[model samples]
Target: MPNQPKTPVKGFRIPVDLYDAALAKAQSEGRTLTDVVREALHRYIDAD
Candidate 1:
C-alpha cells in the first residue's frame, strides 16, 4: 500500500484545573506552558 499523508494536528483549549496544573508543571520545569504542553503531547503521541 502507498504511504498516507499525515493530517494537520488540531488544538483544544485547557480547562481551568488542568491549565493551572500544566502552568505549575511548566514553571517548576523551567519551561514555558506552550513548551510543557508540546512536550507532553509529543510524549503522548510517541508512547504508542
Candidate 2:
C-alpha cells in the first residue's frame, strides 16, 4: 500500500481568548495552528 495523508478533523468551537493565545504562540514559534493544537491536546490527554 502507498503512504497516505491523514484527514483533518474539525468543527469544534473554542473561546476567543484561547484561540488568540494559541495563534500567537504558533506564530512566535513559526509553527502551524494545527501543530500547536495537536501538541496541546496530546499533552492534555497524557496528563491523566
Best by lDDT: 2
Q: State the TM-score for model 2.
A: 0.67
lDDT of 1: 0.79
How does each model score on lDDT? 0.79, 0.86
Clashes of 1: 0
- Poorest lDDT segment (10 consecutive residues) of candidate 1: 1-10
lDDT (tens digit, per residue) of candidate 1 on 1-48: 149576566778769998898789889988888667677889999999
Error of 2 at 26 (Å): 0.8
Give the per-residue lDDT of model 2 (tens digit) for 1-48.
139587667879999999999899899999989887778899999999
* TM-scores of the models, in the order given: 0.58, 0.67
- The most accurate candidate by TM-score is 2
Find the 10 residues in a row with the least total lDDT in model 2: 1-10
